[model samples]
Target: MSSEVLVEKRKLKNPPLNIHTLGDRVLRQSAKRVSKVDDEIRELARQMLQTMYSADGIGLAAPQVAVGKQLIVVDTDPEEPANQPIILLNPKIRRHSDDLALGQEGCLSIPGVYLDVRRPAQIEVAYKDEQGRPQVIVATDLLARVIQHEMDHLTGVMFVDRVENSLLLNQELTKQGFSKQAVKPVEAA
Candidate 1:
């Protein structure tokens, strides 16, 4: 397939300033499962990448843009210049190591917030590439954390749900002038 086919071509427009935040009703809803790979989905993925890159974020999910679909785009290559994006369709974490690490993470949806979130240090993910071809990749360190973080958004989970301590959450909220409240912990399966 051509490089053009591998990258989404559509441009995502900026959302209105009134776009919903983390506690909004739209974000909490379970995303719809994607059944087909079409031009629209591909375009949406492209737009997602554009929005993410514009916000200086490494990853973005469909729900973050108010579209509840099982899709995400990630680019964790810090060395590369802007615009290298990876599209993931129906991603699944097939294997994950027991070793855990805490990483400071932020989200595009929940802006001006950062917290230490615990995640597996390594993971093997299986998903369809941009061309709808099956691809499995083993990721460690930052890449693994990025994958896990984006995948959680597909399930309506946020980084705040995985925070290692309340102190970190409080610090983030206080910095943003938001009230501090206890967030329910994400149960490990």
Candidate 2:
């Protein structure tokens, strides 16, 4: 939770990065790990935060903005100006609690499509901060859920793909004018 990558948590009329939507090939490709957490990466994280705020989202991954890097930004309490956003470079989940929680999730990449996804109730994640210093955090509840959802983007997995109800998934996508064919489903665990 470095404040180094902090940006004014306000909606930008025009966000720095353009979010690629569903059916875009960029959203399907796995992201590469960041070799260095330099100023360039910090800038990307800042812009991503701005974009996420503009879109009224809690978290965002680099891949969502068509950047093939294992970077993610999360600010669950965006309404709180003093809350520092989490800028994770090359984030990896170190551990997850056995308890599973089913919650509704929405993605900036796939707007207007919210669906239920089951994930670990808690997670321990290891990642590099904006200054290249290593950091580890244990997140639970909404923070855990948002981090998991954004992490899925790094591996080109959308929340819609993890959704169990095919009928509702298809229906929601259709209503949003998105083709159901765009979804590449993940086999249930």
Candidate 3:
């Protein structure tokens, strides 16, 4: 995270943006592609990062905050003093590895409901930087998972929608006070 734009700079006393929860119509809406990455987009990214930190989240997408733009902020390393948060604008997956792995995942929107979801072990993504420059990253492990998970948001998909364990998914969503009907299960490919 840059010193000037760190979440701390936003003063967590109150996050400027509100994260929409599961079953919300906003989360179901697909985000629009950002044609320009200007100060407005950068500010939204910063605010999203702030809200994520406040909610103890590692990744967040524009749709989570009801912003219909293809923007995402990810901080795979939040505990480390040198936090490296990634700001991606209009991200698109270019390629993904054949290997798939199941990982436990949770969401800021669907609080307290964590479940296992399968995802590609590695991926190559093309996205614009905060400054509007094109960039690509080859990520593996947690980084790969985070990118995929957030990308799903861009297309109006939630992690629960990909969970194969219907039993566990129902149990967790019920326990978290979220409706099971909110989940739209997609058969894994």
Which lDDT values do the candidates have, in the order given? Answer: 0.75, 0.92, 0.88
Candidate 2: residue 7 Cα off by (Å): 0.8
Which stretches of model 1 miss by more than 4 angstroms?
Answer: 5-20, 179-182
Model 2: runs farther than 4 Å from truth? none
lDDT for each residue of candidate 1 in 121-161, tens digit (9 for 90 to 100): 99999988767778898999988988888888788887888
The sequence of per-residue lDDT tens digits that candidate 3 reaches over residues 19-116 is 99999999999999999777787788888988988788899999999999999998887776566788888998899999999999999999999899
TM-score, each model?
0.85, 0.97, 0.94
Best by TM-score: 2
Q: How do the residues 1-189 of candidate 2 rate in per-residue lDDT, one tens digit apiece?
A: 346777998999899999999999999999999998888998999999999999999999999999999999999999999888898888899999999999999999889999998899999999988898899999999999999999999999989889999999999999999999999999642
Among these predictions, the greatest lDDT belongs to: 2
The residue-level lDDT of candidate 2 at 133 comes to 87
